[model samples]
Target: MLTTNRLRQQLAQKQTVFGLIASVPAPIMIEVIAYAGFDFVIIDMEHVMINPETVEHMIRVAEQSGITPLVRIAEINAKEILRVLDSGAMGIVIPQVEHKEQVEAVIQAAKYFPIGQRSMNSGRPGIFGRDDLADYMERANHEIMIIPMIETVQGVEQIDEILSVEGIDMILEGAADLSQSYGVPWQTEHTLVRQALDHIQQVATSRQIPYCAIPRQINQYEHWQNKGVHAFVLGDERGIAFRALQSKLAQFPVINTDRSQTEL
Candidate 1:
């Protein structure tokens, strides 16, 4: 059964929420993050190899692990959105959203009629064939989260119009991609990129909508925290694991992999 989105509640209360990206499509990893007590988990199908069945498994784990589960869909396709929602994801994070029409399409595919045009199929989240789903539409619309990524210069410029669309629960940023769009590929800290993010914050603030930042460095958190941004996405599974392992391995000397030196 679909329950109220606690993530939504916390955000409504102006509490800062933290989450890690799910780059590894494993239920165990989902449990680890949940037990570690993050506010939510993003099931990343965009850059990860997560299939529908895998998403369902991770959602099951998150349900029990005490974390809100969201999926970052590959694109803003209606069927893809419906499939994951039915699999029990509480929200969606759309990537590379640069136009108001794209935002409108996402809202339409995510919500039921009277709000938007999501198809009627109570497959799993609504308990698979519930006769009262017609009645559940209101609750469903209320609980589902709609988040769009502002990853391009065009997206930043169109923030006001995109945020104007109804049913958008939150806004997410893609620093790396935004930097790329600014002609500074992978330079998330470039002044131009940083300014663009602040612009997003400014626009979202004007509209009274919550905005989330994915920090590329540690100090970025305190900066955004002062701006009163709603949430932060720290890192993904692979990056998290790699950093931990690298830290632990730092204690031991590395076997220099310079084969040229050893060739003699």
Candidate 2:
């Protein structure tokens, strides 16, 4: 496996590693994120339409580019977790991890037997295709990271127990989902959501596990950094496109003039 320095250091220092998400699933976009200098580009499998082959290709490109590739599997199943890990994702983010049991289930799905129950395959990223199944399975389980998303109120309550799990290396706060759950809307910095996140970060800091925030909000970065948050996923593929398109459109003379005018 290519060395994942940024991710490794974040885990070690409990410092935040900023990155982006890829909802669009195009390999070419990997180049954009890599060149953009994000720590990682997660290929989303939760809501986006990405095939296994495409994910593998994206991971391969990410490996070549030195940008860590992470996969957020939609479900908590062994087959799904194995598919992504075998494709060479440096990390796996499981959604809706609200309790210790659910986190344990994700662990089993992403890790090998004894530790968990992820089926082993030396297809591309294992032993250079030499097919050393036994050793590969053993090492892969220990080396791969399992990150759980705490998005619900229930998850917030159980954050400590989930982070305390042996194989769980990191936590991600699903601000949008969490906000909606609390009936406060999907703003990341809504007071209620921010309070909830502060609590989560507190627990993470005490336990020394990395907590990756979604989207890098410049306003909140310093505060979170001071609070021991090291893993920050800056934005997603679609978000970047939308922002860039808006910025570019605003540069047009007519568009700028019209947009800047106040209605009489």
Model 1 per-residue lDDT at 160: 85
Question: Where is model 1 more than 4 Å wrong at Cα?
Answer: 129-131, 254-264
Candidate 1: pairs in clash: none
On residues 1-264, what C-alpha lDDT tens digit does candidate 1 reach at each position? 577899999989999899989999899999999988799999999998777898999998998878999999999889999999888899999999998899889888989989898888877778776658876777789999999999999998988888888778889999999999999999999999999999988988888788899986778988998888869898897898999999999989878787888786
Q: Could you give candidate 2's per-residue lDDT for residues 70-143 as a string of tens digits?
A: 89998877788878888888778888888888778878877778887676565776746576667777766666
How many clashes show up in model 2?
7
TM value for model 2: 0.89
C-alpha lDDT values of all predictions = 0.89, 0.79
Q: What is candidate 1's CA lDDT for residue 93?
A: 94
**Model 1: worst 10 consecutive residues (lDDT sum):** 127-136
Candidate 2: regions farther than 4 A off: 1-6, 13-16, 127-132, 255-264
- In terms of lDDT, model 1 sits at 0.89
